[model samples]
Target chain A: MCGIAGLFLKNRALEPELGAMTAAMLSVLTSRGPDSAGFAVYGQAMPGFLKISLRGAENFDFGAMAAALDVDVSVHDDHAVIAVPLEREARVRALLVQRFPEVAVVASGARMELFKGVGQPDEVSKRFGLVGMTGSHAIGHTRMATESAVTIAGAHPFSTGADQCLVHNGSLSNHNDIRRKLIKEGMRFETQNDTEVAAGFLSWQLREGAKLDEALGAALDTLDGFYTFVVGTETGFGVLRDPVACKPAVMAETDDYVAFGSEYRAMADLPGIADAHLFEPEPARVYFWERAA
Target chain B: MRVAAAPVAVNEPVVFDLAAAGLRALNAALAGLTATTNQTVWRVKNPRGEHAIAVGVTAPVCIFVDGPVGYYCAGMNDGADITIMGNAGPGVAENMMSGFVRVTGDASQAAGASAHGGLLVIEGNASARCGISMKGVDIVVKGFVGHMSAFMAQSGNLVVLGDAGEALGDSLYEARIFVRGRVASLGADCEERPMTDEAAAILAGLLRRADARAEVGDFKVYGSARKLYNFHVDHAGHY
Candidate 1:
């Protein structure tokens, strides 16, 4: 069983506390998943630039790549977030492919920075300084690795589209069939994880001009299996569960924030939780809350 | 002359703080009790969604859990009266042999799955598969129940005071379902049967026992059509 926790702040005043709140929510769910943990934070966006989260090989020279790419890079453990001009994204990716072949672009967007690693949730959260992070929203996952290997590449909070991230708590039965169809549609995958296929499916739909909600609606018809998926986009936070909905999911919402957890204990200590509206997300329905862009 | 207040039977409840103690200890304490144990009242504090709060109890006791609970709160229960003051996770009273379990708040999927006997009551709505494969157990939901409820149920009665989701009873076997509100859709071989005098009496009894506020005449009864019981070759598509 995997655990998924997410926080979306409607009140910008809570942005500075997003990481701490999300970390606490994810920590209580360690028993649900203890092998690996991952998270994606959507912080402030810089005008005319994009923040690309990248992971490199052991002892990789990030400073040299920064010098060659001529971008602002902040190193954090084995991962770094590089700020590049929006126009230069293609050229920078090409250069990284040519020179720094060992560096993988984990996620690229205006505001989102994704980080994940193989370890206990506390260790992984500390490694990425998740408690001190400041963001408008965040999605976290701790995986027990049922159908895949326990590696960083197989961790969750997979971001296949810019500023869009997804974490799943249940397995997909027909991911391979969908994966083959997506590969034929020109979607490249970095791992054989079924969740990657789901993320890629959503990304493909969004790229095909479907709105976020529409993409999720399309997923209900195409994907088969038990799943409670929490997703984050540029301006929205959403949840979708399969028709069967065996996977446990509880949600709490108040004027301050909207939170999702695999279980209620994961959300019991959140701010204003005592007065929040708590309920379970229904089956085969898409629930989305968006911030005014 | 004013009568003195009847001597208050203050048997201070045996409190078990889940936050301060381990789950094993709490279960062991409950397990230690027999039918005639004097410690008949228990109060579980800070449940905080912990699982298996009071499972496999043979003692005739009353347990009041103060907060929400995780999966299988009262699994395999026998002769214990368990109540949750807050919501319950999946399989709240799963496989209960005989006892009484009630949830004051909503319950997740498979609330009383495959229970052999006893009465399970939910004051709030229950998610999918409310009483799947129930055998001789009685479930009364004051609110709605989700899809596939009472699926393949062999015997017993399920009463829902609110609406029911899709596939109310798929592949049923002699289990009776009574719903007060609309049914989204019925499952294969499950059909609405005209309420008879016996069925009405049964519904009345369950509502009286559950203390539910609903008219007995405003309900519909559903049970297996028995077409798929033997699995004829013509019914292969259903298989």
Candidate 2:
């Protein structure tokens, strides 16, 4: 199992201290998932397009591809960091669909910066400015590969073509069936990781006009297995645990913000968290954290 | 050597005084001793499910818990030797990095969950999901274990001297499970594998270490079939 943590601050920009808070939260959970670490910070000044991070199997030349579509691309050790211009985001996405269809673009952002790498939390945090950014909310994952290969691309917060990203902690038993259905529906896949398939499935639901909560609820019904997931969008964050509630998820909410993680140790670092009540989320519960509008 | 079994004195300042004094006495006995040389004796007259009564001691202190204990009675223990005279609650030695935890009575769920390194011996039955997600902990239970025991177990040796419940070793990887009794069912991709000589030796060693009389040859080994490690269309039903 991996460790996933996020903070959602409503109606306010996350304090600069949030970077330290998030880093501290992720630090206590390094043992839960030690293979790789990554985080996504969503702020008001962020862009509206998806920021797809690609890693492993570095045969594709992202610069040429980006140049072809007038999209900006940065490469880092098997990772293809692409920032699609807001106006031509659709065109760039179409270009990606046409090229390098086998690469998993795990996680995206507008003002949300995402960075992941293979190693300890401190290593990943240092490699990708995960420690010094502020936003309304942020989600991070540390992976211990059980089913998938241990690589940066296989690391989570998987993103679709839209502004949606997800971090998962449990196995999706019916991932192949869901992957087949999605493939039949013209959805392409990049990684052999089941989590990518889950991300695609949720993105498909959202594109089909399902609300974030409804889409996740539908996933809870159709996807069979023990899973705890946290999804981040441009505007809000959401968390869901599987029906049997086999996986652990503890969440505490005050009037100002909500913090959740696979274990209480991760959230123990949050400020103003007095008398934080910790309990397992009931089976099949879908919680949404929006701007509270 | 005979410690009388009695209920923990609750709401009484005298018993509290005695318990505190007992701890101090044990600490004094354990002073300037190594984990191997000490073998200190603790006579817990009334151990009514108290959490963390004797924990985190590195010396080879021998604690004879005269009665049952609550959650994490000897959790995160390193080097000290604990022998519970009665049952123990969930996570008896959770995340124990080293040392030994021996429960003479039954153990609750997650008996040794996430113990990175240690030797845990449960002489009685273990509840559901025992040894879930352990990392390098070695557990030997002389009785049955409930369903999903050793789920997603990364690295460990879980030996069940009696029957095992459904889905034993579900999604299991690397961890080895040896059971002497019937298995109710196997979880997704978990199957009974032929016992190898190394596994037999390991089982024999664990049984001998726990002082269990059970024969090693009578035990069957179960592990992940490795079918669900990657997604496949043919094995969709197992999911």
* Residue pairs with backbone overlap in model 1: none
Quality class of the docking in candidate 1, CAPRI style: medium
Native-referenced Cα lDDT, model 1 = 0.91
**TM-score of every candidate:** 0.95, 0.56
Query: Tens digit of lDDT per residue, candidate 1, span A77-116?
Result: 8889999999999999999999999899999898999999
Off by over 4 Å in 1: B1-10, B231-239
| Per-model TM-score (chain A alone) | 0.98, 0.84
Q: A138 in model 2: Cα distance from truth in Å?
A: 1.1
Give a tens-digit lDDT track for model 1, residues B1-239. 01112222335577778888778888988898878777788889888888898999999999999988999999999989999998899999999999899999999999999999999999999999999999989999999999999999989999999999999899999999999999999998899999999999999999998889889989999999998868589867866
Residue B40, model 2, lDDT: 52
Interface RMSD of structure candidate 2 (Å): 8.9
Q: What's the residue-level lDDT of B92 in candidate 1?
A: 93
Candidate 2 lDDT, B114-138, residue by residue in tens: 8888899998888778899999999
